[model samples]
Target: MSESVIGQVATTATSQARADVIDGFLGTTRRYTTSSAEGLKQAWDECDLIISHLALGATTRLIAGLLVNKKTDPGVVVVDEAGRFVVPLVGGHVGGANELARKVAEGLGATAVLTTATDALGLPGLDTLGWDTSGDLAGVTRAVIDQRPVALVREHPWPLPALPSNVTEPGVERVERRGTHVKVLPPPADPQARILLSDSTAVPDDLPTVVLHPKSLVIGMGCNRGTSVAALRELLDATLGVHGLAKSSIGVLTSVDAKADEEGLIELAAELGVDFVTYPAAELAEYQVPNPSAHAEDAVGTSSVSEASVLAHGAGLIVEKTKTPEATIAIGRTEPRGRLAIVGLGPGAADLLTPRARKVLSESAVVIGYRPYVAQIRSILRPGTEIVSTGMGTEDMRTALAIEKAREGRNVAIVCG
Candidate 1:
């Protein structure tokens, strides 16, 4: 199980001791003596889970107006001063408060008060179905809990577990034609409200849709050594827009290995919130491409950087190379690798590290950091693990290396002090 950074708040010393007991059990816990609004605010921002040794109402009031979304908010658990009941006061499902409450209750021998309907009825909510999914989560979940019929449409052959009886496919018995529907396909012509699951850049602008981008697009480029990020951004936006693609669908930005340290490409990828990867020119030259350039081959030892790099990663080119004054860009769609965990290990002390941090480190094929930080976790790494470390003043180099490894479908952990 992944451990959590728990924040404990209490008013009195006795309450603090009780909270400390729960903290010790959870590990990675910090105690806050001040129950003031400011302290609660700081905890809300810093911790993954917050346990307040106060009444439910008081806890709710302290965190008032700070709630963002189910995806980003911290799980809030409230325990009565007497420690009789552990209640998940907010972020019960998506933020993992319900699970945290159960763990706390089990540790303290208290009752866990859960009120989420899916948990109560022992059925998985439609919203709980993982992936980069977006839609009428509340509407579909409500329909499922009330046993109303729902339509599920999928374009790709993604393996979904057995859904509840209330949720059915397009052609099932007693299927509701006019009720809420979930679609896991490309944008349809109809402009009706529905949940959309797609990684394609093209989506129906006319529909009341919830778009789920699966991070399937890869952008390949070759640019002048000092090309400005603005120029790259303009070209990228135009290219993607011309192809009717969504920016969020992009998974990574790629280029020739020589451009690995190209500041413009790196900055653009960072601004787009995607990984940047580079392949050697000799490696890229091996891939057959539609537009082989003699000039490119003479310059970079590859006939084509934009097209060959895309195909080198086992992706089919969607848009052929489009050129700007000093840059060439191409787009490709590939099978999704999907997820990455970027963890921060504060202070480098064993006691200070969270269980989740350790779990991530043990599971990673590549452990990267400053040399001293890598040495701190040297004993716990699995056999045959790849350790990539750089000396001081090389933080960006190590980070880029870690991202490159992850882009190649390896779990990577970067430890920091």
Candidate 2:
């Protein structure tokens, strides 16, 4: 669900005005104001964040026993009657309460009381390091804040942000393994206060470890004609289970060009919420794979459909070809690619353009547009922005170039008038 912000107000002129101001700042579609405590509780259950224009004591008493863990609870920010201070009452980092308090304080011209140590010390919390993570966040964060030694182990050299000085990889410096540590293994046999970055579904039973699922796996498939979707899905699920791989990590489903029209393969990819890609048979034949079948070579002009198709993208093979009666599947891991945002710069006017459109333009590595449209937002473009332009008559060429740039793993923006 999309994150929603709500303003909880009491029956007072000042509270109502403050709520209205907050609603205006956050946008009306997903922001609301409620007068009753019952309404606030309902909003709390439905929304991801709540800004209460009430006394901190009253707000605490209202949500007293219902407060849950930092990971699951909604972010709660309490604003005083005078709007002098914005205090995050619960779910500071993981639930984004601390960040929300800062934003709310900025909008209100008030002070934000942030009690989290990492935020004060300019260090990032371990839980907030990756896309999807869950584990003993509180323990590890506390350990890091207290300047204790922690271990970092990674299965793959996935690109990550620079960790704090206290967190180090094993064998870097001889430090006692006495405090909370972080590990990026699949599933450690003995668990401690550790953080794990893995796409494996198998979790440790005893240790308090955070598991982060990076979108690293790609599945390549080749199926016989007229195969049923149910059979293919079952085989794919079993294969992932046997390898301790998470379905969430599958970035794309790939195959040879011969199976592009296969409905079963397409449906499987759609159900898994990943893109389906096809390579030419000749292209797939260029890669050397462990298993080469003579029958597959005669049938599709590629000796190894699944492995070769995955390796054709320069990905590392993690799983060999496993087959069913009508299907064959392989898995590979690859680094994530950049996304493309096709935006329209409206009316060639800065005032007419939306803030989101401007932000996309600034974030884009390559901006493609007609010459006149590119000139409109030229001042706002960031440094190193590659501008690709065409004349007014060549809209098709602009679109094709934008698509090619995106396919090459660049964040592109196609601006239209």
Candidate 3:
């Protein structure tokens, strides 16, 4: 899913010539070319994006029956007969039609006719943040666009783009009891419309909120030699449920190296779709956990296995060791490390951009560079990427800004021409 499959539909000789030029800019070795209606259907089934050198009306008519949804459908971009104007026909924001159209226009020296409201206004679309998001998308986006107040509730500090001023953290209030004032607590903001950043599976009741979950939790486990996977699963599920933590937030399952060959831990990690890692006993013994055991020291040369392994990886213990007859489990929260990529865009041409540079650009949440250089790679950026473009002679300032953005846990790309 990281790389996109591009299909070129060109029945006429002139269209085929245009397709060849676009293909060179795509930087893909495999070419899927089709010339008939049947071929177009096949392309739709296999391709992630379709470049049709056909009339806008004709392309629409052909793809009308194949449309599934913006989430599932391939982006469709139509290039005119003369290759003068490129237009995004469908899935403009969600399926990457807008970005693909920009790339195609750059290669052909044509204008990209973009009409998406958020793109036109230089605002981040809600659907394009590369997170699992749902609920009140259009409503929240409209609130942002209109400069209306939109409250942001976050369970953890995530590396995100610079949002507009309209989206702000909510205020708190003090509630009073029958006769005395109680503790001060922050009431939920805009129950009818707000954004919630939480990895917990529990959804707020009767609230029109958009939820975005961040991967932050790590699970540390220590099990007996032949613990059953079913027993371990039951204990893990109970731990998460009792603590109101989401299993989706579990990023890694770790233990001491003594359990490296344990079948139960390996199988459970695989079933949960997370990485399984182990730390050596000598390494795990460095961290002083609250609940250290002499029995564990005699068994594995480490005073603590479940808690020490988590702290060894720079995570804070959110949950202490909870154990069953044969297994022990602990949960910790880890901060995400930020990344900074200084990419060189050779020759300022679409075809000249290297695959590695293009990948960094697309994965970055923020792109900082000179105005011209930023514009050159703008088409390759995913939706919701914040661009910080300055004039020439500001290289030092741009580099500093990029570093600061990365420090905030964002993937930042500083593009140079």
Q: Best-fitting candidate, measured by lDDT?
A: 3
Candidate 1's C-alpha runs over 4 A off are 1-6, 10-31, 47-49, 68-73, 79-86, 93-112, 123-135, 171-195, 201-210, 336-417
lDDT of each: 0.73, 0.73, 0.79
Candidate 2 — which pairs collide?
Answer: 135-210
- The digit string of per-residue lDDT tens for model 1 on 1-417 reads 135678887778778889878867787587777745766788898898888887788778878899888788998998888898999988887777887997899789899998998766655444444345554566656665665544455433322333454444443233211112323333323323444556655444443344556567789999988999999999999998888777777878999998999999999999987778999999998988888889888888898999988887777898999998799999998854412467677877765777678767756656777777777787766543656766778788777767775675557777877
Candidate 3 lDDT tens digits, 393-416: 778877887888788667898888
lDDT tens digits, residues 276-361, model 2?
89999999988989988887888889998899988986678989999987989999999645566778876778757886886577
lDDT for 288 in candidate 2 is 88
* Model 1 alpha-carbon miss at residue 407, Å: 24
Candidate 2 root-mean-square deviation in Å: 12.5
Global Cα lDDT for candidate 3: 0.79
